[model samples]
Target chain A: MNPPTPRPQPIGRLAEATGLKVPTIRYYEQIGLLPSPPRSQGNRRLYPDSAIARLRFIRHARELGFEIESIRQLLDMADHPDQSCADADSIARRHLADIQSKIARLTALGEEVSQMIAGCRQSSVRQCRVIQVLADHGQCLGEHLAGSVKINEK
Target chain B: MNPPTPRPQPIGRLAEATGLKVPTIRYYEQIGLLPSPPRSQGNRRLYPDSAIARLRFIRHARELGFEIESIRQLLDMADHPDQSCADADSIARRHLADIQSKIARLTALGEEVSQMIAGCRQSSVRQCRVIQVLADHGQCLGEHLAGSVKINEK
Candidate 1:
C-alpha cells in the first residue's frame, strides 16, 4: 500500500513557521484580521498553508507602517484577484508623502533643538539663553503646529 | 517723576506667551515644573519675567522631543550657572543618536514598503504577487515589526 500523505499544519506548527507567537495569532483571529481555522478531533486549531501566507502578508504590511484599517482594505482588495491595483498605488503614494512630510518637520525641529541646547551655555537659570528664546514666541520660525491643531479640533 | 515700569505677567498672559493652555500651565505648577506665582487681590496667579522664561524653556524642550524627566534635569542644571556644560552635551548627544536610529529604521522600512507595492501587478488574489510575498514569513528579508523589545531586567 502507498504511504499515508502528511497532514496539514496544526496551530502551534503554523505559529512557529510564521514567526508569530501563539497568542498574537489568536489575537489576530479575534480581531477578524485572520479567520478561525478548522479544529482537529482534539479541539486544537488546524491551519492550512493558506493561513500561513495570510499571516505573513499582515506582518509585512504592518512593518511598512500601514495602519490596521489600511491593511484591512488591502486584504479586501487582495481577495478580489481580478481588480486593478490603482487603489494600492494610491495608498502607497499617500503613505510616502506622509513620511516625507514627517521627515521635513523633524528636520526643522532638529535645528530648533540644536539651537536651544547651544543657548544654555551652562548659564544660571536667570541668564539662560535657552529660556529666553522659548519665551519669545516670535523666535519660533517653523510651522505653527498645524497637525496638532487638527487633532485638537477633533 | 520716572515713567511707570511695565508690570510682570499674570498667569493667563504667561500661558499665552508660552503656547501652553491655562490648565496645563496650572498643572505644571502643581507638579513643580513651574513655581507657584504670587496671587493678585482677586486671587489670580501673577508671574514675574523669570517665571515666563522658565515656561518658554519648557515649551521649547518639549518641541525638541525631550521627555519631561530630561527637561527637568536640564532645568536643574540651568539653575546652577557655574557648572560645566558636559551634562547638557551628553543629553543632547544621546537624543541625537536616538533620532538618527529612528530615521535609519524608518528608511529601511520605507524601502521594504516600496518593494511590496512594486510587486503588485493588479492581478487576481490567486495570482497576486504581493499577497504571495506577504503570506510567506521565510520570504521576508526585512526586520519590520509593530512592537519594540523592552530590555528591562527584573
Candidate 2:
C-alpha cells in the first residue's frame, strides 16, 4: 500500500488557507482576538482546521465593515453555536444603519461639491465663483457640516 | 452731528465671518496657506475685503474636498488676478476627478457590503452566509479597493 501523504502543518499552512499574512495572524494572536495554537517539536505554531475557519470568519466580518471590536463581540457570540442569533442580527442591523448614515452624509457632500464646481465654470480668480464661495462663509449652506457647531467668536 | 460706526480690521472680521475661531485661523496662517495681513494702529492685524474673499475661498475649497495643499496651489494661481482661467479650471477639474474616483470606490464597497448582508439573511452564525463569505477571502471581487484590501491582512 502507498504511504499516506503528510499534511503540511502550522503557521504556513494556516496563512495559506486563510489568505492572511503570517504577521497579521501573529498580530491577531497578540491582540487576544485569536487563541494561541499548539506548537510542534520545533516550537512552530500549529493551527488545526478550526483556526482556519475562525480566521476566515474574522476576515469576512472585516470586509463587511465590522470594526475589530465588533468582530470580537461577534466571535464570542458565535462560540455558543446553540445560542439565539438575536445578538448577531442586532449587530448586523446596527452596521447597516451606520452604512446608511455614511451614504447620506457623502451624498450631501457630493451635491455641495458639484455646486461649488459649477460656480467656477465661467469666472476669473478675481471673480472666481470657487474663490468667492470659499471667501464668503455666508454663502455656505452646510456651515454645520464643515465640522462642529462650536462657533468661535473673536 | 454725524455718528461713526467703527470697522474692525480683517483678522477680527474674518474670525467673526467664518466662525473658524481665531486659533484655527492663526493655524491656517502658520501653515503659510494664508498670507499675513497688514497691521494697523497698535499693531493689530488689519485685513482688507480681499482677505475676506480669500477666507471664503479657502472654506469653500475645503468643503469641496480640496486638501489644504491643493488649496494653497490654487490660491497662489488666483493671486494673479489677470492670469488665464485655464489653471483654475484645471484645478477644479482635477478635484472633480478625485471625487469621482472616490465615489466609484465607495460604490463598489457598498455593493460588497450589501451582498454580505444579503447572504446572512436570518441564518444562524454556524450557517451564516456572512461569516462564510468573510472567512473565505477568495470570494471577494473588490481587489482594487485599497482600504478594504488592508482590513484583514494587517
Candidate 3:
C-alpha cells in the first residue's frame, strides 16, 4: 500500500502553530526563507507539516540574536545535513563576538550617564549636571564613547 | 547699535563645521528637529551661526543614545534655561536605566551564545552542538530568550 500523504494546513493554522504572525509568515515566504507552499483549490496557501520545524528554526535563531544573513546561511547548512558544522560554529562565534563588543560599548555609556546623573544636585537647568554633560560631551568620562545610538534600535 | 548680524553659513560649511552630513542636516530639518533656514538670494540655505551650537547639541544627545522624542523635550528644556531641571534629570535617569537594561539583555545573550559555541565540537552537521541548540531550543537553558535580535542593530 502507498504511504498516506501528510495533511496540509492552512496559512492561519501555520501561523498559530509556529507562533509567528500571519504577516511575518508571508514576509518569510517573500524573503525566500519559507519556500512558497502549494495553494488550495480556492487559492489559499497550504503549508506542509515540515514548515513548522523550519519556522521554529528561524524563530529560534532570531531569538539567539542571529542576523538574517547568518540565519540564512545556517538554514542552508541545516538543509544539507551532511555538511560540516564549521560554518555554523563560525557564525555563532561571530555573533557572540559582536554581542560582546556591544556590551562593552554600552557599559561604557552607562557609566558616563550614571556619572552625569550622580553629579546632578536637582538644581535649576542653568546648573543641571545632566544638561551640562549632554550639551558638552567633553565632561563625560568616556568621550571616546561618542557614536550613533542607532545600534539599539536596528 | 544693534548687534552685528550673525554671519550666515552655507549648507556645506554648516556640514563641515558640525561634522553632520548634508543629507543628515536636511533630514533634521525635514523632521523638525531643526528649524528651516532662510534661503539666500540664490535660493540656497543660509543657516545662522547659532545652528552650529544647536546641531552640536543634537549630535551630542544622539551619541548619548537619547531618542528623538526625548531629545525634543531636552531641546525645549535647553531653550528655556530658567526652567527647573527636573525634566532633564528624569530623562537622563530614564536613559541611564534603559542603557543598563540593554546591557543586561545583551550580556545574557552573549553568555548563551558563547556557551553554545563552546559546546560545539566542530563535528559534522549531524552532531553540531550549535545546530542542535538552534534547531531544538529545548536544549537551551534559557528557552524564554526567543525574541528579536534587532536590539543590537538598533
Top candidate by lDDT? 3
lDDT tens digits, residue span B10-61, model 2: 5666888765667777888889877787777778777666666677677666
**What local lDDT score does residue A27 receive in model 2, on the 0 to 100 scale?**
89
Cα lDDT tens digits, model 3, A39-90, are 9889999999999999888887777778888989999998888989999999
lDDT of 3: 0.84
Q: What is the TM-score (0 to 1) of candidate 3? A: 0.90
- Tens digits of lDDT, candidate 2, A10-51: 887788877778998998999989999888888888776788
- Supply the DockQ value of model 2: 0.31
List TM-scores of chain B, every candidate. Answer: 0.77, 0.75, 0.89
Docking class for model 1 is acceptable
User: Across residues A1-154, which tens digit of lDDT does each residue of candidate 1 receive?
Assistant: 8787546788789888766788888988998998998898999888878888788777667666677777787788777767766676667667766665555555665666566667666545555555445445456556554235221210
Error of 1 at B129 (Å): 5.7
Reference-based lDDT, residue B59, model 1: 71
Q: What TM-score would each prediction reach against the true structure?
A: 0.70, 0.67, 0.90
Clashing pairs in 1: A53-B135, A56-B134, A57-B134, A81-B124, A81-B125, A82-B124, A124-B81
DockQ of all predictions against the true structure, Cα-based: 0.28, 0.31, 0.61
- Select the stronger candidate by DockQ from 1 and 2: 2
Judged by TM-score relative to the true structure, which candidate is superior, 1 or 2? 1
What TM-score would you give candidate 1 relative to the actual structure?
0.70
